[model samples]
Target: MKLLTNRTRKMDVILIIVGAFIMAVGINLVYEPMDLVTGGFSGLAIIIKYFTKGFIHGGIPIWVSNILLNVPLFLAAFLLKGKKFVGKTLFATAVLSVALYIVPSFDIVYHDLLLASVFGGVIGGIGLGMVFITMASTGGTDMLGMIIHEFIPHYTIAQVIFVIDGAIVLLGAATFGLNKALYSVIAVYITAKVMDGMLEGLKFAKLTYIISDQYEEIAKEIMDKLDRGATGLHATGMYSNDEKKMIFCVVSKKEIIELKNIVGGIDPKAFIIVSDVREVLGEGFIEYKQ
Candidate 1:
């Protein structure tokens, strides 16, 4: 087994704490002020708070409700996911719950549902993305998703999560009304998009395949000028039955123009195919982790 270095472990803890705090800010500051309900345990807490406001004095604060709801789920996660997984999840959930209590809530940009939804989504997405980067979850529907995945291995975790969170959003609609429910959907969508962006990285790359006669010159230029590597593959022209070389390379999106110019300078008739690459992990990109 590989052991984690001290710094890596410390960074994991920091990420969990900061992520939870950001999520709390999004919920309390943005969603709560506008009474906008999104999915997951947090949304359920908001619903509980709204209903209990009449009978329960100051009402059930989100932190209390969040803890109350997570208790049993945490127990289940420990039993199912084992100690290591449950430990990180517990850390994140605890931080989030406590943050809900400590973080002061006030409307910074009020009376605008659109702005609230957009900002809340962006903030929450960043928080969730950070937690995910540590390979830990904030333990709400995340736990539920794992549990559901165990039972029905055929259905993807994401599919199960969507169904469960969708149900909660629908319940919010019944409790809050249709308009708020629709707004909640918008928030969820924005949150998902932003989260995906964070996870996949905002800076994209391009993978290009060049079929040209001047493959050696082009490859040399790419390696020398762009500081990028290129691979030459042996190929045959289907029409002419002549041997040829295909150069394959990956470069940043901005570098695509430069790459095209280099290829054009070498061989104007070069057949080049450029495709968007979501991620590239190697010498010039993200380091591959075991």
Candidate 2:
């Protein structure tokens, strides 16, 4: 058991390293060439790179700026989140910093700003998502987000991150032109969405609630045909004072049509409500693991 746990930890470390490297490559190759500012320390580093273009040869290297900017943020994380959180975060940050220095900046000369923004966001988002899955971050705005969340518990980490990134992008507009800043916003949006998809798992499912006269038949068919379990709850119709059974079931996105067909065949006027389920864990779904 101990060996297995150690193996899992090792795997997580490897994943974080790979993810951080990908993120660094995206920044150096795509964001740098296009002069696009994203969010977090990376975006700030770009902004710094632009303002101080003639400071030392071709401005201060992004890796240096990234490390300098992250120092205070890392300290904040250690104070607010604890050593355990900071340990992995620091490792990921170091990986990203080294990668930004070592990775060669590719010259991707292109006229389409939209394409650059999209590719940059996608590549960076995937890297960020992988790092996040291991419960670690590439530091920068991630750490700041955690600190902000500590003080403001009501706000989600993503919301706080957006606010921080948005402010940085605005600063970017001052230096990198308003048009590029606008495109940068698109990059940020795509990055956020992709990261969300990765963190939540792409295998999205649907949670359905059905209220109908033939509830038992529909439930039985769903169980027998779809091989899914349904739970029944007694419901009262306020308008007619009619007692009814509310059938609740979760089905894969692809199975939505089939489930709808079964319900319609049983009762054409069945009241059905379907909503997206991001992640589900149970006997038939993902195992609930600590």
Candidate 3:
């Protein structure tokens, strides 16, 4: 057990290092070159770096601006998520911010708009996705999403993130220009798509509940026809005050449509509820039984 845990820790460290490097390259080479503001602290940095002039510019550099924006987000993470999460996210963000600040001081790179936007989005997306895969976030709107999630459990973290990020982009457009804003949107779109790509195969299992009179037929059909496992849970109808079979099954996203169709055909009036499950460590879904 100790050996396995150590190995996992080592792998996480390696991923963080690589992910941070990719994020830095994207910011310094791609986004910075095109003068495009993205969705996170980096985006805020670009805007602040441009507007503040003379003494203010001299006092607060891009790196400082990034730190300023991230401080609040990091605080939120610490308060909401805990120290470990905040520490990791803050470490990652600091590394990225420092990288973005120092890289330009040493070297110059291509500033072409097309190349910058495409490569920046790709690298940034992959890095961010890697962070998410490790059950951590790089703070910013991600932290805000957690806070919102506490208030609104039904809405997803990603949805809340979108709302916050969209507003930030609009503000950037007003401060910078429409062109910068459009490019930022493109960068955000590409980043989100690539992040999804990175986590594509890590699909979660689904839990389906079907309440219907034809539960036996539906359950049998699901197990026999779809080769899926199911259980007949005892349930009572509140209005009818009568016992019924609640067909309960766990399946992957691929098997869901077939399961739903079978239940629908058997009993069109069936009540179906589906939810995304985090893990299912047993039988057909996982190798190890739990």
Best by lDDT: 2
Ranking by lDDT: 2, 1, 3
TM-score of each: 0.86, 0.82, 0.66
lDDT of 1 at 206: 95
Task: For candidate 3, write residues 116-178 as lDDT tens digits.
Answer: 666677888898777766656666675676667778988755556666777778878898789
As for candidate 1, its clashing pairs are: none
Weakest 10 consecutive residues of candidate 1 by summed lDDT: 155-164
Query: Judged by lDDT against the true structure, how good is candidate 3?
Result: 0.74
lDDT of 2 at 269: 94
Global fold similarity of model 3 (TM-score): 0.66
> Mind giving the per-residue lDDT tens digits that candidate 1 earns over 137-173?
7888867877778899987554566678788899999
Selected candidate, larger lDDT, 2 vs 3: 2
Q: What's the number of clashes in each of the models? A: 0, 0, 0
Report RMSD (Å) for each prediction in the order shown.
2.9, 3.1, 6.6
In candidate 3, the residue pairs with backbone N, CA or C atoms under 3 Å apart (3 or more residues apart, or in different chains) clash, namely none
